[model samples]
Target: MADTISTKQIIKPENLVHKKSAVMTDTTMHYCPGCGHGTTHQILAEVIEELGIQENTIGITPVGCSVFMYNYLNIDMQEAAHGRAPALATAIKRLMPDKYVFTYQGDGDLAAIGTAETIHSCNRGENILIIFINNGIYGMTGGQMAPTTIVGMKSSTTPYGRDVSLMGNPLKMTDIVATLPGTYYVTRQSVHKPGNVRKMKKAIHKAFEYQKKKKGTCFIEVVSNCPSGWRMTPVESNKWMEENMLPFYPLGDFKVPEE
Candidate 1:
């Protein structure tokens, strides 16, 4: 004979530490385990939920691994062309001034092909959020070297490590955007650990808040890990990112509006 557990004992809300955000869909994520995309999606969804703007939010996804952000975030989503998320976001926000618009783009999509759109959008002071994921390589199309790929970093395209003399220096898109006078808030964050996730959430929340104020462009660069693309186990990739990626792309705010 076995004893049955009581409903009260099983349903202890007080002991619950975390729960899935209602803004996320039921579809299982396709990202590799330990990929930061899932964590970023969760944080974004949680921010939308907390701000009670699920219905009024619009998200633009680029043609990278994060292109499926529409499938995960339970909000109105528009698929943008390759490296065109920022432009799409600019148009949507201008057309629907009352709606909250944001773009989710990977390094290749933002720092490389979309460089013009990114720079112009921020230069124009578009009131929208830009979530840039910089994992150093093109995570979706193939682990090709990206504009943000660090020199000496190995990739499918740069099998022998990136040569600065040949490939040019890694573009610091976040810093570049921050330099634009139209940008109101710009920050770089990561989400590999519990404490880091908390900080990322705060940065995301601030971006959204600034959006509501009709402030200039708000940009957030999430220095993420791409274990599958990097050809390393999840743990090893994170370790490498901390040791290698962090130095080039240091975390924290690069620009903020003065009170």
Candidate 2:
């Protein structure tokens, strides 16, 4: 009988293309299949590791699918009430000025119930990062329409489709935030594809770097897909988001401090 070669001895470690970030805990993510939260968390973990701020960073998670972020990311984390992440983050940052503070919020948490908190915190020029994941609908709350839910977008609340005339226009929160004087940097990105993922990673890195500089609110909005909420498969949601969501929430930097 021929001797079997050991697998570890056959493959070189140098050829490895990707590895899990050390900042991410072994805890399994609880996000729905094809949800963007997992990818977003991975990128955030990579940024924290690469910036060498893993030990000094503090994250605030709001009431939404992202609430589990504290368990997945191997860093100090705090939980806040629905739409209250910014408020909690503001206090945390004020108390621990030396720490890298950030908030992970969903569309519903950031743009709806937490609207006041979100606006006030950014307006105050808090030196913290806001990672907003916008999937248009309230993903974790039985797919109800959210403040960011676009026209004609279907949700449990809008079974037929979103009627802008009756429901009000979709709130462009990122654009609104960018216009505020306290916001030092703002950008919209996605992570459905490899190129977009790379771009989003860069944006996250820049946000963290700016945070260190004490730059006022660095907001990064991730226009992501929610297959479960959208009533589609992961691939279908990605394609639909590309065709429908991207046009309204265009990707690219919306604001940056002038040198």
Candidate 3:
């Protein structure tokens, strides 16, 4: 008879392809299925663990599904008012110059209500990382049209689809910030696929590195999906994001400092 190996015998550190980061808390995430926030959080945890900066990192989360980030990431977290994450992050970074500060914010909070704070923070070139999640629609506050909502996108506020003539064009906040002198690095990425997830991780890790160099502000915009909010299945939402959102938001670096 052939010898059989126990499952435990097959499990080894070398054989482990992946494992949940200890930097991430064991608490289950509250993001909707297919939501990009969870994936972004996972990469954030992995980057923090890889850099060995778990204790030195501080996160600011404002109003949105992202506000629950503190529950998932095992790190110091601060809560901010709606659309005020950038402002909070600014203060924290200034007071704790040695600590790595970052803000996890949504499109509504970052682009719409907190536009002033977002712009000013990036403009000031604060030594912090600003992770912007643009799901198109307002996920936590019901399916409402947000500032980043692209043309013809349907939302509770735009059931017939967004009319550019009346609603105005979608704001390219990342592009806006990239032009600011204070921004050292600015890029837009997504986590809808395996490749994109890897790319986002790299971008985030790079941003962290730049922050350590005091390279002003580094911003990463994640074009994410909202399944429940969009009333679409996970698969359908990803496909929709690929076809629709990608064309409008388009993933790639919008800014980088000269070497």
Clashing pairs in 1: none
lDDT of each: 0.92, 0.92, 0.93
The residue ranges of model 2 lying beyond 4 angstroms of the native Cα positions read 1-10
Better of 1 and 2 by lDDT: 1
Indicate the TM-score of model 2. 0.95
Residue-by-residue lDDT tens digits, candidate 3, 1-259: 6599889988988899898898999899888877888888999999999999999999998898888889999999999999988898889999999999999999999999999999999999989999999999889989899989999999999999999889999999999999999999999999999999999999999999999999899999999999998899999999999999999888999997789
Best by TM-score: 3
Instruction: Please give the lDDT score at residue 97 for candidate 2.
Output: 93
Runs of candidate 1 with Cα error greater than 4 angstroms are: 1-11
Evaluated at residue 138, the lDDT of candidate 3 is 89
Candidate 3 global TM-score: 0.96
Candidate 2 lDDT, tens digit per residue, 187-211? 9999999999999999988888888
What's the residue-level lDDT of 48 in candidate 1? 95
Which wins on TM-score, candidate 1 or candidate 3? Answer: 3
Clashes of each: 0, 0, 0
TM-scores for all predictions: 0.95, 0.95, 0.96
